[model samples]
Every structure is written in structure tokens, then in C-alpha cells.
Target: MGIRVAVAGASGYAGGELLRLIAGHPEFDLVAATAHRQAGAPVSAVHPHLAGLDLVLTATDPAGLADADLVFLALPHGESGAVAAMLPTGVKLVDIGADHRLRDAAAWRRYYGSEHAGTWTYGLPELPGQRALIAAAGRVAATGCYAVATILALAPLIAAGVVSAEDVVVVAASGTSGAGRAAKTHLLASEVMGSLAPYKVGAHQHVPEIKQATGAASLSFTPVLAPMPRGILATVTARPTSDADPADAARTALTTAYADEPFVRVLPRGSWPATAATLGSNACHLQVTADVDSGRVIVSSAVDNLGKGAAGQAVQCANLMLGLPETTGLTAFGTAP
Candidate 1:
């Protein structure tokens, strides 16, 4: 028998994506899929793309998920913690919610306005020693969509001493799906199309996560709501610390850090990252250069919000936790037009 798995909150965008990914994973057998509002509905009813999936959505409960070897908690922030605590101790968990990603309880309480859910082994494998940590962990917190995009672009620079941690600025644009599958007036087709709206200008929830993962002491984060359906394009700029040419140094740091990574691609010089190139894949496309006039180092990173940022990330960690190859059933190639 294959590794038995389950997904909680399978009706939402990320959850549906998780269902889709798990369906294709050869060694992972999806045993149960649970949802709150969509309980008793067939999985295909909520996720039309998963039409052939014969499973019916059950209510999100520990008992329904306990039989699985691993469970992916895709419930929204503040909900996963309660359910997670009740799950069987033998089941490995990967939470794609914001509940368990922060290390500092104070930060968690301040941002989420609730008690800390406690930290899990962070699920960004590209980070130093993180792959091993995820493999050894029973619980892993998948990196936030925005957090992964920014961290992948910023961490190597700070770790290599090519950029100063004190002053870092990131302006990121994310497709509307990052807002989740809920119906909000602001997310209306008319409101988002042809418009780039900036929200959570300074106090984005991912700010703390980015700093914790990248070693950035201070950050100015601006997140934009794009009109499309998926992907994140983040432009990160930081003060250069070395005398070496900023572009060369930043590229060297990024390339060196991700040299052995299967999912991170440091694009060739003069080529920049775009959201489309990373669509439908777990790849993070990156390109680095220096602002000729300001001498500041700039790195542009792109990723599919549902892929490297959430569902795919959870699957990667689950693979490690289950003693499977890190790249098992995962791909770096994106579907581009």
C-alpha cells in the first residue's frame, strides 16, 4: 500500500490545488479530503478541475483524518491549530496555513491577534539545513506564499554577506488567488481587472515570516493585488555591503546558494523573472542585478502562489517526512504560453 494521506479544507484554492497534486503523486494515496462548508459534496463539485476524483468531501474532523499516515492542514489561519492538536500523534502533518509558521509567539499574537500555535519545522527546503529539518519533523509549516517568494530572493544575499540586513525593501505583486477563494467585493472581476491595487502596505502578515527566514532586521514590504489568477513576482532591493560589483556579487550569492537546488532556477544574466514562466509549477525563477545609478542590489523572484508557495511546498515536505525523494512527484517546469 502507498502512503495514506488526507487533506483538510479541500474546497479552498490552495486546498483544491493540494487535492490535484496529491492525486498525481504516485507514492501518495489520498484517503480522505475534508471541507467545512462543502461537507458531503463530491470533491469534483467544489473543484471542477478535479472532475474524475471520486472522493466525497467529509467534514474536517480529527476522526475522519486519523486513519491517514499524513494529513495536510490547509485550513485558514487560526483554524488549523485546534484541529491539528486533536489529530493522531502518528500522522505527520504539513500545515499550509499561517498558524504555525512563526517562531516568535509575540509576533504571532500581534499579527494574528490570537495565542501562538507554536512553530513547526518551516517547509522551505531551499533554506540551509531546512531539508534535513523537514525530513526529521513530524509537523512542518509550509512557507507563506509571499514569504517564500521574498525569502528565496533575499535569504542568500543576507547569508552570503552581499547585502545588509538593516535596509531591505520588497515590492511584490500577487495574483488574486492569493486572497483565497472567498467571495469579497474587492475581488470582483470588475474591481481587479486592469487595476493594480496595493494592500497591507506595511503590516503584511508575511513580513515577520520573511524576516525570520531571511535574517533581515528591518523590511519595508509593499504587496500589490494583481488581476490574474496565480503566481507572485517580487522585486527585492537591499543595500550592498561589499565593494564587489553589486550585480556580480548578488548573482554569485544566488547562484551559489541554489546551485544544487532542483526547484530554484537562477536565470541567466540579463534575463529577468516573470510570473507566467512559473505558472503551474513549483519552480522559483530568480534573476539578480545592480541598479547602475544607486549601486543597490536587486533580485527579482517569481513563483506560482499555489505551487512553491503552498500545496506543492507541503507535498515536498511530506515527501521528505515520509522518506521519499525530495523531488518525488514534483516538477520544476512551469506551464507557459
Candidate 2:
């Protein structure tokens, strides 16, 4: 009798996380789960952690997902568009892909090398007026993992006019799960362990989306692939528009902006965010300070990429679209060892 839901890319890291979260959600009945090569396989085969979930994977088909009231398209970038177009218009959708996140067609084509798939209401509820947009949207585009962390860090300062939007810099280290479940020689255990490697130095697909969301005139993003399995630690820095104590202004902005939010926390001064503190939860932990030498505001952000960056975010949007409380089935606290 609950709201029926389906997941289209149910075998990857994000998809598996969605299934896990949905299984625990009180009002969402996961009626269908589809995958490409994972079709016909039991959920446990691919997601060993989901051994108790009894559903068998079905091939990714719009027809198979039609009965659900909502669908989460966790498909790869550029793939969700076609499937979303074929779905019945009545079924609400939350896409955890780059397919619908960008507003600029030219930017999409340049970065993804594909024709534009059009845009959807953005899914980051913490941004001003975004919760209402997500609540009213028939389809929403969830934020990229890195974008989620970086935006949450930088947006408040820009909105408060405390930081110069003309120049922003982000250097983030993300766990390997952000790379997806595909088999690549670079992701081999021996290659990844103890290695902190930076990739996509200058051009990252999330660049335009971040710019569109935060209104930053320019951003220089560098992403490092860390050895761990599931989190993101982003260091976002920006010059201050005023010479006054940017650190205090930055902290006040962040704390005020997210004070009432259920999942984003602006850590108490002197505290810092660590990837371990936000693991396995929808929570994003943040801290603000001024760099000693440059006086630029530095905001450190942390989140489980597969959680708030993808599945947990998609579910939060689904709750709003379904007229349920935003925190109905999501948790704000992360687990610790």
C-alpha cells in the first residue's frame, strides 16, 4: 500500500545504495529493480551486502518500470535521457545522472560529447528555493557527487556576498566508488590502494552544473581518486569580496544557511569535517576557516558520495514529490566504528 518505486540501474554502487535505503524506507515499496548486464540475476549476486533483498534484477526497460509511481534513473551519464523519455509521463522521476543537470546545451555537448537531453529541476534542497522546486517538479536531476559537496560548501558564502564569485577553487578527494562499478585497469585494487591520484584535472563534467547552481563566474576543480570505498572530502576555497574577517563571515553564512536543514551541518568552530564522519548517511558535514596566508575563505566539506550525492538525494526528492515529509525515511547522522 506504499508508494511504488523502481530503480533503473540497480546493480552499481549508487543503485545498490538506493536499494538498501529503499528497503529501509517505510513508505517506499521497491516494486522493481532493473539493470543492464545484471538482468535476471538475484540482487545478492551483484550486491553481496543486499543479500536479504529478494528481488531479481530485470533488464532496463521502461515498460518494466511503468507500474511504479516513481522511478530513479541511476543510469550512466547520457543514458537516462532516452529511458526517461519513454516512461509514462505520469511516473515521477529522479535522475542521478549528468543527463539532465545542465542548462546549457553547448556545455553539455562539449563535456559529454552527446546531444543535450534537456534540463530538469535541480535536486539539491539546501539551495535557496530549491526544496519547493523539487517538491513541485515531475522530474528532477540529482547533483553530481563532487558538485554536491563543493556547492554545499561554496554557495552560502556567495549568496551572503561574503566571497568573490569571480574565482573559486576546489580540490577534492573522492573514494573510488565515485568512478562507478565498471571494470577498468586503473581501478584495480593493487592500482588503487595507497594511491591518491588526480584525474580530469582541468575539465570535469560537473563544472557547468556547479557554475549554474552557485553562480560562480569561474571555478578551477581538481578531483583526486582516493583509495577508500565510499566518501568525498572536498576543500573549496574562494577569495573574499571584503577584507574583513572572511573566516567569521564565512562561518556565520554557512551556519545560518543550513541551520534548519535536516542533513547539512556546519560544524562548530575549531571542528573539521572528515569523510569518515559522514559515511553511510545522507548527512554532509562542513567547516569554515580563513587560509592563513591568502585570507581566502576555506570550507571543508564531507559526505558519502553514494548517499547524499546520489540515492539518498534521489529519495529525498521523491518524498517531496509524493507529499511526504522530507526526512520521513532519511537519516541525518552517519555511523562510526
In order, what lDDT does every prediction score?
0.94, 0.94
Model 1's alpha-carbon lDDT is 0.94
lDDT of 1 by residue, 226-292 (tens): 9999999999999999788888988888999999999999998788899999988999999998888
Mind giving the per-residue lDDT tens digits that candidate 2 earns over 237-265?
99999988899999899989998999999
Candidate 2's displacement at residue 146, Å, is: 0.1
- lDDT of model 2 at residue 152? 95
Error of 1 at 71 (Å): 0.2
Give the C-alpha lDDT of model 2: 0.94
Worst 10 residues of 2 by lDDT: 328-337
